[model samples]
Target: MHAGLNEVTLPAQGWMPTLQSALREATRQQHHRLDHHPLLARLVRPGLQMADYGRALQALYAINAPSERCIADYIAAQGYAFDYAAHQRMPDLLADLAYLSLPVPPLAWAGPRLDSPGELVGCLYVLAGSTLGGRVIFRQLQSVLPVTASAGARFFAGHGEQTMGMWQNFWAFAATICSPAELPAARQSAAALFERILTLLESQSC
Candidate 1:
């Protein structure tokens, strides 16, 4: 599960494309590692086991619960009009855990820093982009696991039909708010978040 262990490099400076595009290009390697993370990749496997799915859920909860709080608090304190609460995954994770009769684990020891707008946007980019992937995973899980949007798979089901729309909205907002000077931090934070999740998955048995 050493998915995101490598160092990150910032994209070269020049005439900028979209913020989301720049971040994606900067973090492509880390993103690929996270996509192939064993705990997550197994969800779509034909032999996917309930125990593995449960462990993945718990691991996700550990990272997402604290990360959501950190993002929410930052948005509120800074008066950022990002509508941060609307994108929360903690409740869905909790629901899925309860449906599976699994205990809610403690938060990760730490969360990614949201100290600046660039940093916060980077964190949001990683989190928001995941909802898009969740939709795909949710569909895959349907054939392998006894779960649904309202049951043990709510976390992956994400924003349901609005997942794509919400993702677009996030990037649009990010483009407007994330300035060029802040891009380095944004890129670093996004890459760091992927690494943090990989580290947590490896270290935590839940």
Candidate 2:
């Protein structure tokens, strides 16, 4: 919603940097910030505790639930050809919370608005990329915590063995649906979602 963003548009295809590359470059700093955020960092620390892991899940759930809904709703309303349900993280988050016997935290913020297809794609990029990253964290958590995909680490466990395949499928579909004209909106929305999550985590005890 910056001044005159609506007036600026690129071609439907043939952009120099692809949408994924552009999104990664635009949100690189934000991505690094989140990776080192204390609460998240605590998950992979040698001294990681079940309590710390539980708190982290609660914090993630606060932002994840609502943000996911926004994307799913947008996809449905727009009649987009995406199978967003297959990529949703909330179910796994909920399972982990249940195993830990932690209540779902109230939403930390309003979540992002995906009023356009470009915006929805941007949010999807962040969410899907996070899923890929979570696999690494899952392995790290396995060494420290007594949790597994079923017991308490379901969120980080992601799609298990099929994760890479699913991730590639998502990006391929994203490349097709996202036009050059939508890259700015996609980049801005992806960056903003990362910022939003960082803000939410910063405000929490984790």
Q: Name the best candidate (by TM-score).
A: 2
Tens-digit lDDT track for model 2 on 1-206?
22121222344234424776898899999999999999999888889989889899999999888899988887777666667788898999999999889998999887788777678778988899999999999999999989997878989999999899878767655665677788889889999999989988888863
Clashing pairs for model 2 are none
Question: Per-prediction TM-score, please?
Answer: 0.89, 0.90
Model 1 lDDT tens row, 1-206: 11111211233222235676789998899889888888888888899989999999898888877888888998788766567778888888899999999999988766766888789888888888888888889998899888989989998999998898888667656655667889999999988888888888778743
List all candidate RMSDs to the true structure.
7.7, 5.7
- Best prediction by lDDT: 2
Each prediction's Cα lDDT score? 0.80, 0.83
**Residue pairs with backbone overlap in model 1:** none
Q: Candidate 1, which segments miss by more than 4 Å at Cα?
A: 1-17
The lowest-lDDT stretch of 10 consecutive residues in candidate 1 is 1-10
